[model samples]
Structure formats: structure tokens, C-alpha cells
Target: MSAIGTRAGTGAAGWVLADSWTMTRRELAHWARQPVRIVVGLAFPVMLLLMFTYLVGGGRGVDGDHAEFLVPGMLALTMAFGLEATMLAVTQDLTKGVIDRFRAMPMFSGSVLVGRSVADMLQSVAALAVMTGVGYAVGWRWHNGLTAALGAVGLLLLLRFAMLWTGIQLAMVAGRPEMVQAVQILVWPVGFLSNVFAAPESMPGRLGAVVEWNPMSATVTAVRGLFGNPGGSGGSWAAAHAELLAVAWPVALIAVFFPLAVRRFARIGG
Candidate 1:
């Protein structure tokens, strides 16, 4: 009996994985059909990187190369912004009844969300590569070795994973494509409130404290440390232990939003 139950659990897991892959393929197909969307998604952050590196110029309290400071911050910003795309896609499916159509089939319900996340993560990787190339072109280089660079990448993607589910939960609640645009605007504040373009130390006292505690700030600081970039070190405890908060913040967010997104998705059409 125990053996039978174990096999049943394994089979259920396999079923979900297979269905999720199928849905992932369906999402990738949309990328082909709508190449402009993918291009725009990838390009926006690159444009921002160039704009800041050259046009805006100078980082307050940044000790060394501004590119060193800016590049990691931009990567974290890109991850924060990636949620808009996820939000838009989820709400579009919800509004157009695509999710409803999928629900009519025998596929696993949560697989749809899982598949969307996988496809979004793929785009995010591409975005990071593009941003990294652009950063290198603009004179940003990781002083750390390859393994540390990969660790930075892992943290960036972990933050993106957390943001992905947050977007999904928000999209499910928004329930319409047009509403997504309005809802997504809220992300910009969260992005800019961090110590992305400037050091938290440079800000006014209370505001600097707030910036230091930002989850995005934690990620930017942690990634900067891993990449051996400037602006990673800080006097504050938040700055001193950024790597921990980087992991913990995202885990906390996922712990809250992943289940919320799944629960909300389950209630659709019920």
C-alpha cells in the first residue's frame, strides 16, 4: 500500500511537470509571434543602463567607478521591472479567457502559472545577458571570479522569481489587461526608492534609513559585493548583511505571494 501511494505521488508530480512544460512552450510561441514585445522588454533596461551611465552621470557617495556601482543596481532594477511583463501577460490571459479555456482541459491547474513563470524567467536571463553586455560595453566589469559572478546572477534571478509571483497575485486580483498598466505603475516607486542610482548614505538621514532597508537595496548591495563592485559596503547593519536580506526578503515574499497566487488562480471560474 505504501509503495502504491509513493508511485501515485510520483505520477502526480510528473503529470504537473509535463503539463507545465507544455504551457511553457505555448508561452514561448507567443514570443515568436510577438517578437516586438520581447524586444521591447529586453531593450528598456538596456536603454536605462546607457542613459544613466552616460547621460545622467555620477553617483553620489560612490567611491570608484560609477559603472561598477550602477551596473549591479540596474540589474536589480531590471528584475523589479520584469514583473510588469508578467503582470500584463497574466491579466491578458485572464481577461481574454485563455485561462478559462485551459481550465476546461484535464491539465493541472497550477501548471499554467508555473509555465508562465518559467517563460518569464527565460526572458529575464536574456535580459540579464543583454544588460551584462551593455554594462561591460559601458565599462562595468565584475572584479570577482566567475563563481561569484554566477552567485550574483542567482540572487538576481531569485529576486525575479519572488517578483514573478507577486505579479501573478497582483494580476489575478487586477483581472483585466488595462488595469495591469495602472497597477504596474506602482512598481516604479519600489524600484526608485532603493539605493540604485545613488548610495543610501548620500540621502537625507531618515530617507537613507528607508532606502537601506529596501529589498531591492539589499539585492543591489549583495550583488555588488558578489561582483566585487563599489557601493556594496555600508555602515548600516542592513548594508553589512545584505546577502542575508537578499535571500530572506525574496523567500518571505514568495512565502506570502506564491500561495496567494495559487489560491486566487484556483478560484477563477469556480
Candidate 2:
């Protein structure tokens, strides 16, 4: 009897882990098959990075090497870019009845959503690595120590995780792939309103104040601080508060959205 109980417990644990792994692998395979989309997603940010660094960068009171200032902003933009892919995948799964099929399976019920989030984060990591390489090619370098470098990576990952939940929530609400485009339209303004390309001080007063406080701006400010880039200024409070806000805002967003996304996933087709 004791041996049977122990065996049953181990079996259950293994089954749960297996379900999660299977879901994660399935999503990863889908990405592998869609290499072109991945490339396109990555290329846009790199193009923007180059265009801003070489073209618009010099005119904006952006002191120091533009690539360095631009890299941090591009990092935030890349996270924003990832949301569309997540929303599209989730919406596609729902519309094609793939999610329904998963619901019918005996696998862990939450695994599908968890798997998508994991796969997307892996893609984000790859995208970040590629962008970092591109930044290096264009003369961006991290002047901070290794610890600060790692911290910047951590900030990016946290930001991606927060955005992932937001994407999942959007997917749940969208219910169809076609709706993702409409959702993506909202992302552009959020990206543009942030201090990504130029200093907030250069903007008109009211607009600059808003841009300085935008969450993406906080992230850019924090990353620029980490890189020792000089673009962050104006609103002395923001300059002092960027790092804490960067960490807190993402944490708060994830805490709120993760549960909402999970609950939404649980109610699919209900």
C-alpha cells in the first residue's frame, strides 16, 4: 500500500511536468516553422535603431554616442513589438479551435497559456541577444559593470513578462486573430509617446511631461542610467525615480494581469 501511494504521487508529478513541457514544445515548434515572421519582427527594431541612431539622433540634443542612447530605447520598443506576436498566436489558437482541442485533452488545463508565455519569453531573449549584437555592430557599448549589465537584462526580461500578460489579456478579449491588428494599433502610440528617440526636455512642455512619466520612458531612463548614457534629464524626480519605477510598474502590472489572464484562459469557450 505504501509503495503504491508513493508511485501514484510521483506519477502525478511527472504527468503535470510532462503536460507543461509538451505545451511549451508545441508552441516552440510553431515558431520554428514561422521563421519569416520572427525575422520581420526582429528586423523592424534593428532598422529603427539604425535610423534613429544615424539619422534623427544627432538633431535632438541627444548627447554622447547616439547608438548607446538608442539601444536602451530600442530594447523597450522590442518588448512592445513582441505583444503583437503573442496576441496573434493566442487569437489564432482560439479561432482555429486549437485551444478547444487542448481543452479536450487530459493534459494540465493551464499549461497552454503558460506554454505560450514561456515560448514568447524565449523569443524575447533571442530577440534581445540579436539586438544587442546589432547595437554592438553600430557602436553601442555598456559602460556599466557586469552587475549593471545583468541588471539591465533583468529589467528587460521583467518588462517583457509584464507585456506578455498584457498581450495574453488582449488575446483573451480579442477572441480572433483579425482583432490583433486593431490591438497593435494601440501599441504604436504608447511606443511613440515615450522618450525613445529624443530627450523629453526637447518636447513641448505638456507633451514632454507626459512622455517623461510614461512607463516606457521610465524603462528607457533606467536602462540609459545603467548604460551611462546621458539622454535622461528633466523632471529631476523622474531621473531619481526611474529605476524604482521601472521595477515597480512591471511588477504591479504582472501581478494584476497574470491572474486576469489565467482566469480568462480558464473561462475559454464558456
Give the number of the best model, judged by lDDT. Answer: 1
- Segments in model 1 whose C-alpha atoms lie over 4 Å from true places: 1-10, 58-64
Worst 10 residues of 2 by lDDT: 1-10
Candidate 2, 38-138: lDDT as tens digits = 78877888888878887787666555577877898999888877788888888888777566788997677888887888899998888889989999998
Candidates in order have lDDT scores of 0.89, 0.84
Leading candidate by TM-score = 1
**C-alpha RMSD of each candidate structure in angstroms:** 4.6, 3.5
- All candidates: TM-score: 0.92, 0.91
Steric clash count of candidate 2: 0
Residue-pair clashes per candidate = 0, 0
Give model 1 RMSD, 1 decimal: 4.6
Residues 1-270 of candidate 1: C-alpha lDDT, one tens digit per residue: 445442344577788988899999989998999999888888899999988887777433433388888999999999998788899888888877576788897679999998899999999999999999999988899988999999999999999999999999998888878888897778888899998988887788998899999999999999999999988366899999999999999999999999999998988977
Residue 218, model 1: lDDT of 98
Error of 1 at 3 (Å): 32
